[model samples]
Target: MDKETAKNIRESLKADCSNCFGLCCTALNIVASSDFAINKNAGTPCPNLNDEFRCKIHQNLREKGFKGCTVFDCLGAGQKVSQNIFNGQNWRENPEIAEKMFSVFPVMEQLYEMIAFISEALTYEVSFSLHDNLNQQLEKLQNLTDMDADSLLSIDLVMCRFPIKELLLETSQYIRSELSSKVFAIKKGKECSGADWIGKNFSGKDLRTTDLRGAYLIATDLRNTDLRGVDFIGADLRDANLSGANLSTSLFLTQMQINSAKGNEKTILPSHLQRPYHWI
Candidate 1:
């Protein structure tokens, strides 16, 4: 899928979190962060993950030093493959079938990567012909991704490894420099508001003076996406990875958005800017 299309799918996904089964946190091997010192095996739920499936340590993950967990984004793996495909059966509640679910998780994760990449590819006008090819691949991945755990585990691991590796490489390429030829120009100055562009590749695109107020830009690859002079007022920046992103001159950056966005020690904030209160 092209970049634009990928973005659209991702945007719709954020709104559907409640439907997810919390699969990644409960069904995969995760080395804990400060808040959670222990690593968890596939099919075992994280202790910090609460009954509601929300992270009990969400707010204090880092101060509590669970930095490793804080950076994770299943890229909506929980909702798309787990909730929608498997009908929300997570490994935690099905230990007898835990191995089956664990085996299927990576398979679905690879597919989720494809979905995200294809969605990104679809956004560009020049990639129109790619639509059919992407659709085919997406359908195939979706089929495997949505399979019942029994069927999912029965697949040959040796045979499936090659395809997953190939897909992962192809998907990675799109996130790099592939968009230079299809650079975006917001002509007609069409207004965009409250849009969800999380985990997308809007890198290096000039979004100066754009109105992105209240948009959900979580984990978006904005490395070089221009934010020289835009309104970021009220945007939900929750864990939106902004490393190397230039927001030094952005406008109306609310305390909430700044707090939600993730930054490192090297982040260059404009003078008079205050770090978010909870980013520790």
Candidate 2:
């Protein structure tokens, strides 16, 4: 796929709550914690979800103790499942299909997430050699999304994600390799792939091209950090300080990760991402 096409696809992958049926509010289970005020079972509508399929406390979700809701991003799967898969039929009106719809919702979520990653990977000039492979995978995943609800439920998400993960890793390496060897030498022995750095202070550090994939960065401090070309896929950034961090060229950073973290107007983000409303 060309860059323009890929950009359009990436734009479509963003969440459009107005076109959705509040699947995230009803289909997913929620536990009472700092992120949530009450326990909620899977397939049960959140008490705050009203008849119009909108959150009643959307304007004040954080204050109302629904922080989790504020961080959740369905990547446009909700509308796809609501409008395309089930033809706009909501679970409440169609009780017979409720269970199946709920089951299919999460499956679609995983698919959309993969699609989002692949679409972003396609736009990288460093990954040109892998573009053919990436485009093929993107097409295959897009086709899967167009499948019926039963086919979506039958998908083996783990198997589907394995190859995509490998591709993303390869793409990440390509992007990071463009940096000078001296830069890597400066941060030698600081390889943090999947490392536990929870609550660690990394304020004002030069972290260019760092491998933070799957890293535990919960509540870690990263204020004013130079994070360009850093691989942040699957990194837990909850409450991590990003007050003045520059992530303009970071690899595989998503909106959900940005939303879960704290930042300010001074934080430099990629062009495709929006600054969180909660950010100061």
Candidate 3:
């Protein structure tokens, strides 16, 4: 796929909450924690969700102790499930299908997330060799979204994600290798994949080409860091300071990750990502 086509696909994968029926607020379970004010069960609507299927605390989610709600993104699965799958019928109005709709939501979420990653992978010129495979996988995922609710529920997400994960890793390596030079390497340590760097001071460091997949970077100081070409898939960036950090070319950095972290107006992000509303 070409860049423009890939861009369009990525845009479609973003959450359009206005067109949704509050699936994220009703379909998923919530655990009481630092992020959530109350425990909620799956298939139950949040107390804060109003009659119009909107969150009453939409603007004050964090202050109201629903921090987890702010960090969650369904990757457009909510609307897809609400409108496309159910023909605009909402769970509150159509009580008979409520349980089935809730069950299909998480499955759709996984598919959309995979599609988002593959769509991004296809945009990198360095990963052109994998473009054919990526496009095929993307097509497969798109087709899966069109499947009936029962078919969607039957999907084994583990099996579906295995190949996509391998492809993303390959794409990340190709892009990073093409962009990063020896000067961008970390001098002290060679490995960073899945490393536990919580609360570590890495501010202003050149972290280019670092394979930081699944790294625990919670509360880590990364302010003003040069992070071009770093792979951040599954990295715990909650409370990690990103003020003035340059991630314009970072690999696999998602909106959810950015939403969970802290940043300032000086922080640079990829062209496709939106700066969080809370960022100063």
Instruction: Report every candidate's CA lDDT.
Output: 0.57, 0.89, 0.88
- The C-alpha TM-scores of every prediction are 0.54, 0.95, 0.95
Summarize candidate 3's per-residue lDDT along 69-181 as a digit string, tens digits.
98889989999999999889988888999999999999999999999888988877844558989999999999999999999999989999999999998888777776754
Candidate 1 per-residue lDDT over residues 72-177, each given as its tens digit: 4555565765665566675557556556655666766655655544444444333343456556655666577667767766766557555544543343333222
Q: Compared with the true structure, what per-residue lDDT tens digits does model 2 show for residues 212-266?
A: 9999999999999999889999999999999999999887888899999999999
TM-score, cand. 3 vs. native: 0.95
TM-score winner between 1 and 3, please give it: 3
Q: In candidate 2, list every pair of residues with a backbone clash.
A: none
- Predicted structure 2: lDDT: 0.89
Model 1 stretches with alpha carbons more than 4 Å out: 1-7, 15-17, 32-36, 80-95, 127-129, 154-280
